[model samples]
Target: MRSGLLVSGRRGGSGRVVGMLHLRVVCPVDATDEVLAVLKAHPGVTHVALFPGAAIEPAGDVVAADLAREATDEVLSALCGLGIDHTGGVTLEQIDTALSDAADRAEEAAPGEAADAVVWEELLSRTGEESRLNATFLAFLTIACLLAAVGVVTNSPVTIVGAMVVGPEFGPLAAIAVGIVLRRWDLVRRAGLALAVGFPLAMLVTFGGAVLGSYSGLFDRTMVLSAHQVDFVFQVGPFSLIVALLAGAAGMLSMTSAKSAALVGVFISVTTVPAAGYAAIAAVLGEWAICGMSVLQLVVNLVGIVVAAAVVLALRNRRSRTRDLGRPLSNG
Candidate 1:
């Protein structure tokens, strides 16, 4: 069975609706006819091309089409059912900018609401890309944690917010959630490894930074200990869990809908960054109690966010399946 479906809808742009997807398919020579038929029959599909034996590596025919994003799931489903995925491959790429009247009409012809659409393949592709464990990911995490540590020592809420905004931890958390919903163990493992290594390295960097700052008389333990704004870092409770849950849900929604502005709120609402910073600072200061509590706070917030995102993604997946089952396939 196909993993999930994408909703197709119109986007408002000076009275022009946009939201088209460009697809490239490598198909076995014998299946080219069926694949071309599938593409040509879809109203949402505007441009179609076929190249016989064009894919040298795969030794197959190449097919390309421009279709409405909403029609992606159905068209892909048809291709998959024909054994295209096993014999060859299918790739979907979003069009960042398009200047075609045909594309606009294709969007209108596609069925469903774009805002309500959930393109599982696209979502998985995107999250998978973001969840990779690499230097960039590590650097962002380390810097974010260090900023959080600075925020703690200075009791600066602005610094804390900046740290939160800079952190890339949410990408892996969301990937984990999507992995669980999709039952993709590989994705789960990748996301888990990224988090496993990223957080500790970030914490370590902050720890070393704190030790140095203290030696230089730049950081005062008393400041963090006395700061009201920084107290939540070491206080993990039901309220903290609630905030993490809500923030995770909102973050997933923003990701699915491409409303990135809401993601900034998600960044600042969770306690992961602050907790990591506090734990590092506390450990350096020999305050074991605060260190333990800060560690617990980090765990709670991470778990809460992951669980909440998973629940939201699973629910959305279920709803998409239901919608797919109820709607009749459009025949162009």
Candidate 2:
């Protein structure tokens, strides 16, 4: 491990807490010195510990350190350039609390505050998990849409809100943007599959449910058409686009910042689930025009989100790269 001036940071005036990351690196014996050199050269790294030949499986040395969150992307990139990511192992964990003046000074030395920093590698890993097409993703989406259909039929905003909060569509959506920004077509295709395959399947399931409910007399066309409170799901308009754009930006930002609370707001703000529900129910009642409009609303929201999120990630990537050019990171 490289040892030197450990950087630390302070909170913003609004009580935004500073961020720290615990990084663990395992590398072959021959690469140990260069890895140490990189850590030693970084101002934002601190509390580095080196254990020679501690790695059993990979059979290498272990290097661990604390870093101001701002420096994580840079340091990881340099290490990857050394091919440690492929040859050995790299892991990261969040540090909730740190009590050291040197750590604070390390943050001060870092280029940016924690809230503003975009750790590309971290974002990619996190979103990569979210974008994977799995049973859980399909299940949640289907359940959320079903809940939303119930909410729409009953004209209950509360139920609709619950449905929105339950939906997991944002994960794949944000992953698409992240993939686009990083030029990871595999990530892009995987996320695209999650969205493309997931949404239609979920909506189809909801449509079947709506049909069953209609036969059982759970809801009829009159009640569905009478639903005014939650009609916003199919109310395609400029504001729909606006809300989607804002929500998409917030959703992507929440992923980068790790502000999960912001995610709840993002989830409730967009109408993806509700729109899908509305479309399914409308189709059951033979309300083709309304169904068409609801599908349009869904498309508008999805497109708006993708566009806004892509722009945000692109700009952040640009800013990070520009910083790299002006002040090159110590790659060792």
For model 2 the TM-score comes to: 0.93
lDDT of each: 0.85, 0.87
Best by TM-score: 2
Worst 10 residues of 2 by lDDT: 1-10
Instruction: Give per-residue CA lDDT, model 2, range 134-234, as digits (tens).
Output: 99999999999999999999999999999999999888889888888788999989999999999899999999999999999999989988889998889
lDDT of 1 by residue, 1-332 (tens): 12222323535433333566779999999999999888888888877888998998788999988888778888888888888889999998766556566677777888786666677877898899999999999999999999989888988888988898999999999999999989998999999999999999999999999999999999776776887887877887899999999999998998886567998999999989888988999999999999999999999999999999999998988988887787655322
- Enumerate residue pairs that collide in model 2: 7-106, 7-107, 8-103, 8-104, 8-105, 8-106, 8-107, 8-108, 9-107
Regions more than 4 Å wrong, model 2: 1-17
TM values, all candidates: 0.86, 0.93
Error of 2 at 297 (Å): 0.6
Candidate with best lDDT? 2
Candidate 1 total steric clashes: 4
